[model samples]
Target: MCPSKVAEGGQRGWIVPIGGAEDKENDKRVLRRFLELCGGDGAEIAVIPTASRLNETGDRYEQIFGGMGARNVHVLDFDTRRDAHERNRVARIEQASGIFITGGNQLRLSTILGGTPVAQAIRACNAHGIPVGGTSAGAGILSEHMIAGGDSETETPRANGVRLAPGLGLTNRVVIDQHFRQRDRLGRLLAALAYNPFAIGLGVDEDTAAFIGPDNVVEVEGSGAVTVVDADGLQFSSMAQVDGDSPVCMLGVQLHILTAGASYNLVTRKASAGELSTVKE
Candidate 1:
């Protein structure tokens, strides 16, 4: 549940990747910790099943909340334009203690829910100290600037390897990419940082998460690691010819890699030492 500062004082959120969920023991642990952050109260788990390909995703969501001791779980089916779906989603977000975006095509979620009334409601949750978390596509949409998806490991320097999509922007000046190590998405994340020095690029490995607290303190959790790319001080060549899919040469960038327990201040753009130390492994 983290400390009281995260649970009751300010905005806190978590980002996770798809197919990276831990076992029941770990899931229960995370849920407990997150609930504590929501003032030790049972969180209203809102599942956006919009991205899922099948109805079973809805069922899986029910199980998730049940395991977390959250009796209030709502699934929003964005595939339908029915007022009922939209109204229900809005109501759920307004009362939710936490929101979770399920794994699937993040682009689909954004396209369907981007400007909807429900989207605004979710933002309100962030404004309130309620922690919002996502796995896979859900994690991808937490940043103001989001990585829709891209080709990794090509090394072809092709443009459009990483597609930039409008995220929910619960947090500003950041872009998040998931399944980083499993997918080797450093290049794309770096490109994103190079393109926008004002933003920090976070690549979260599968089975891992970045738990960000109200003070803008970010902690790495799970078995994997978190990578932060800071290009704010780097000098880069022009991206004029890069277009959308072309890769541009990005040199002199600084990257900080941190494992679990390490923390970084997203606001100051500085990696912390001691309890928040950055380490290779």
Candidate 2:
């Protein structure tokens, strides 16, 4: 079990970006680890499913969390920007032990909740020792720059293959892409980095997750692997000169494929395949 983020009393929390279609029926190790980090037992979990249009999406998570042993699990719905400001609604976010964002349309999450107090409150919680987690579109919006859409079929990087947008401003360290290998998104992800070599590119596969620790180490979990693209030594890029439809030219890019138990240091730009030990308190 992971140490309780809430009990840390101000030890900046973690950002959990889970690839889409996690196994909710089985062990659900990813979600289970998230719950453990949230403080378990009587943990108060808040589910945000605004990105999804399906009315049952939020409620379904509420039930899932409850069944998983969360004593207080509720779905928070802020229909519009105005609803985001409601004190009662914002309070729900502020007082939560854990925050979980469900999968859907990333654009909806950006347009509706981008600048609202609800977004601010969630940020506050994470900044003050509360674990925040998301899946799929939820994962996409957890980063500072999000991959809104791109060519999923292409295996080679193209100048116009990827689209970028502002996200929740959680971390500017990495740009997240979901269903990575399963959907063949390497080309688009590489293209995204070409636009800004400063930010690293993280490609998360289905049933997998990248648990970005406060210490800047991303611990991989689940069955699939997480691809880390480090463009730190990027010598040149054709982002400005290449045609929109042409293949991009680049130099000095590093990539790492990490499976369960492996970790990557965002700050050091290094990879480690060491096993991870459970945290106990």
Quick one: best lDDT, which candidate? 2
lDDT of 1 at 217: 75
Residue-level lDDT of model 2, residues 1-281, one tens digit each, is 11223434456678999999988889988888888888887789989998899999998888778888998987997678888889998898898999999999989888899878888888778878788999999999998889999899777899899999889877788999999988999999999999888989899999999999988799999999999999989999988998778999988899999999999999999999876445344
The most accurate candidate by TM-score is: 2
Error at 29, model 2, angstroms: 1.0
The lDDT values for all models are 0.69, 0.88
TM-score of candidate 2 on Cα atoms, chains taken together: 0.93
Which residue pairs show collisions in model 2? none
- What is the clash count of model 2? 0
Per-residue C-alpha lDDT of model 1 across residues 1-281, encoded as one tens digit per residue: 01222334455454333324543455554445555555443656777777778888867866767666676777767785443246655887788777777778888778777767777777766766667777778888777788877778753334566678788777775678887888788878876666667878787877777787766778777777788887777787446567776667876676788876777788898886545434457
Q: What shift in Å separates residue 248 of candidate 1 from its native position after superposition?
A: 2.1
